[model samples]
Target chain A: MQLADRIEKRRFVGRELLLWLWMESELFDGTLHTEEHGAFGFWLEKQLVLSAESESTSIKAAAPGLGREAKEALLRGQLPERFAVRISKDDEETSLVLTGDTLALRALKLATVLDKKEEAVIGDLVDELAGRTRGRKKKKAESEEDEETPFYERMSKAAEVEALLGTLYRDFLRLRLDARWDAVVVPTMRQWAAGEDVDADAYRAAKRGKSTKGAKGAKAAKGTRK
Target chain B: MSALSGSLSYSRFFVTLQGRDGTIRSAGSAADGSLPRGFLDRSYEKLLHHAMRPLDADEPESERSGWCVLGDPLDVSLPKERVYLEGFVNLGFRTDKWVIPGAMLRTRLRQAELAYREQVGREKLSRRERAELKEVVTRELRKKLVPSTRAVDLTWSLDEGLVRFFSHTASAMLSMVDLFEKTFGAKLVAESPYTLASRLRGEDDPIALDDEALWEALTPTILVPEGDA
Candidate 1:
């Protein structure tokens, strides 16, 4: 595919993914559990700007704290395209900005893990990657705990951030590609986003309870939770 | 540079090379450039030339803009599933006007003119003469003036062909992309609303990408009303 075409197509997925995050947060308290990636937390942090896809210029939601009405306006037809998100994994939290149209995540502020004992943990993590590449294993991760060097620590942290971002991306893809996502989850999320009373947990449980549509069984669809 | 200082923000993107099977090996290293040594060091130079720099008075007035790399990589993957590289993009601007404020310059010239007139017994200095004097004064003052610099950090995943740059300003993102592309020799595929459907559904079938109909079947997703598909 042409790079321009992919660039063009990726933003819609980004916007939808962001909408899913907002919906998941408001309804499920910003937490989602799955067998593949386990429980991950996502929350709106700092400044969050939402706009309608129709509006050429997306006005910031100035409806006060949390801006429920502004968020509702999104459900009426306007969908969230850009916002700041706080994603938590393994008890570590990071604040990042997510632009839905292009799916770009900028300014990720992960908890400072350098200079602390946590640095050793990052080293240990990179150590496990020693034998992945064949001839280039020697050129692998640059983390060195014994050195306590700034370069090594930074490398370790970057690796961790990439892994975290990848996990979140995959989790989003899972939700996005699910057969029921368009049919059931989106509609359910619209209600919750619009401030309508709906049992989000129950709805998720029902989703978890059933096999994916069209697919033969839980094993076939990879949708069942442990 | 620490090679790894600190960043409060970053812009994230995916990198996809042209023409490749889905196999993981194709994702490992860039088609060119090694990490840390060749890539990072060279990239540092590329960025500095683009960052803002202090303008000297003797130098003719022009648009003075440049950037630099702050610290080292928080991560580097030479030949692995992916290479994660992060650095701060340091930017600064030294305007002749800002460094040599008109008000300040005028006042200083007034003082110099008085001294010159008192010593030379002159009423008014010619434009060329005044300019020559101000030029010398501006040069002396500007030499001592320091240009203020600001920086934003970025993370790039070579194999995934994605980058996460930390800036919300559209103008900043554009420069980030330009410097990044120049430094890496690779184009960044940004995620936007219009492109979402194509990215996730871009591959109708890895084996059948050549089929024009397959590409047509994948419709890009746009923001529609809740009831609408």
Candidate 2:
């Protein structure tokens, strides 16, 4: 097959990725992990859209994925088309709407440390005004650094979030391309979608079973536990 | 969303630099500054060559698109200092389109046709004459109107080989990609499921199977079984 054909055909994988993410988020109680980022709070928020062919369902709520309608849509053969998600690591929290087919991130709100930095800058300025410290050259250099700090912080945080996403995608691919996908993931995913209670430990054990390739899948699955 | 301020929303694209041998490769690490020597200088020159041109009232072209200063679209003076940031090549994609209201055009055309007929002492005009009158009327109307302009911020992270285009609209992305390829001789593969997967798998992984074969054999998971559904 041509490259374009392969890309087009695999576009559905994006929807499946989102579906898998939603299932894992609920089963793991909004905590998902990767080898890189130990465990992060991952959950659907604000909106969730699922569609198949001529029909689509859009749910807007504090937790759209927890609703019965979303599950019903899944049963109707619809997959998540796009959804708003909130991810938190330590004190940092990020939110964005992720489009399934293109995996495009929209309205990405990265956690900002600007307020604290601005406060520190204001304190320094106050000290200078009170004649508590600083020379002209020193003050000039400090102010210049202040001006560039927030931008660098913002870019750095954005990069960190992108890296986190990259690792998550890698983990998903590891399971997706392995025999564990059909043997374990799909059944448990179906159970979760049907509102059936799933034993997280059993699911993890099955995911780490011999069906997976060697020790890599088992090690990654181990990381998923809190 | 603007890159410098306001909300942060963007479409990500991975840059693939093509060599003289027609082979494609992902951009090198930012830490090593792995771009070929003088590549930055060459790219800067190309950026200058393709800088945005404001629409002229007398020009016949209905639309035009090109690059400009990131935050200030009006400033097309892309001095190297303004174009290059710490580790990023930041710029804006500006498009200007002349939009003449259809009703106004029809009205002006009718008036022009009537005046022309009277001047020639003819009650009716031929098809060719009408077409010429319409063109003339459109040009006159265009001169009286301003082109609508839109600017979207785009930042290229030199080290990461990633371009964050602020807008998600298809037309805007198409124009930006076309202009970008022209400005820098590199193909941009937009971030998608397949591309991300392949990239994460390491393009140079020796043990990796052929991507085409692996991806081709894959099928979509059936979330709802036939009997179960």
Candidate 3:
């Protein structure tokens, strides 16, 4: 197929990715892990939008995914079109709305470093009050650096969030392209979405074993079984 | 959302370079160093060349769009210092369009037509005459009015090959992409699930499975079985 056709066809993968994320977030109790980032806080928050061809359901609450209507929408063949998500790692929280088809992040609010800067400003005031004198040029340079600090910090934080999302997408792809997707993940997801009890521990064990087996097979094929 | 300040909200696009043979290459491959030597100087010249031109009442063009200084739509001077900020090329995409209300235009045209007919001592005007009068009226009205202008900030990280366009509107993005490709001679691919997946998989992993086939064969999971809802 042509590149454009492939891109258009795979757009649905984004909605499925969001749906899987919502399910995993709930099943894992608002925490998900990857080899790179270990465990991080992740959950759907504030808003959730699910839609089929003609009908759509929009839910807004502290945790919209926990509502019964969200599950009902899923059962009715609606996938998440867009939803707000909150992810926290190392006490730094980032919130953004994820659009399914484009996987575009909108209104990404990164953790602010201004409070720390405020403290630093107070310290600078104290230094000035203590009669500490500095060269005019040096002081001007310092002030300029201070002005740029927050922008750089914000960009850094934003890049960090992007990297986290990239890693999460990678993990999702690994499962999605594997046999375990239909064998394990989807069955449990169906049970959970239908308001039926799902054994989280059992699912995790099965998922982990399958992944390990796949890795071993790959290693063996590479002649590195040991 | 402003790049220098305000709450962060933007759309991400991955930049790619197209070769002469029509092959698309990853931005990472092209990003060998910090935008290459004298690249900024060359880009500054291009910026000046394509800088926003305010709509002129005398001109026939009703709409125009181009780059301007970030946070200042009126300032199209695009000084290098204001645009090339610490590894990022920040600029504002500005569009100006003259919008004349239909009712107002009709009223003005009618007045012009009447005045022209009275001056020429004619009770009726031909179709061509009416068209010429309407054009004259529109130009006169444009002289008395200002074109509405919209400016959205865009920041391009030269190192990361990513562009953060502050506005998510489709038209604005399309305009920006067109302007960017024209100005920089590079293509931009908007961030999507497929593109992101391809990038995260890395460029050198030849053993990686075929993405097209994988994605094509995939089916949406049935979260709820039949009659389960």
TM-score of each: 0.56, 0.86, 0.84
lDDT per residue as tens, model 2, A121-194:
78679888898774555546644554454655667777788888877777677677666776678878888888
User: Which tens-of-lDDT digit does each residue in B1-229 have in candidate 2?
Assistant: 5766544788989888876788777775323325778888998888988998988867778899999998788999888888888988889999999899999998889899889989999999999999988778878888898889899999888788888899999999999999999999887888889877766764443324225544565677777867766
Give lDDT tens digits, candidate 1, residues A84-132: 7666778676666667665555554445532333454555556767743
lDDT by candidate, in order shown: 0.51, 0.80, 0.79
| Residue-level lDDT tens digits of model 1 in B1-229 | 1224343344445444343353221222344422334554565555545444545556876334334333222122122222223432222211223356778878877888888888888898889888888877777667777544335545454444445555556666676666656655555555553333333332322222122332333333333344653
By TM-score, the better pick of 1 and 2 is 2
Listed per prediction, chain B TM-scores read 0.48, 0.90, 0.86
Q: Model 2 in CAPRI terms: which quality? A: acceptable
Quick one: ranking by DockQ, best first? 2, 3, 1
lDDT order of candidates, best first?
2, 3, 1
lDDT of 3 by residue, A23-127 (tens): 989999999998789999999999999998899999999999998999989999899999999998887777889888988777776666333444456766777
Give me the runs in candidate 1 sitting further than 4 Å from their true place: A1-10, A45-47, A53-67, A113-162, A174-179, A197-226, B1-7, B13-54, B61-69, B72-144, B151-173, B176-184, B188-229
Model 3 chain A poorest ten-residue lDDT run: A217-226
Return the TM-scores of chain A for each candidate in numbered order. 0.64, 0.77, 0.77
Candidate no. 2 TM-score: 0.86
Tell me the spans in candidate 3 whose CA falls farther than 4 Å from its real position.
A113-149, A211-226, B20-22, B29-38, B120-124, B202-210, B225-229
Q: Tell how far residue A21 is off in model 2, in angstroms.
A: 0.9
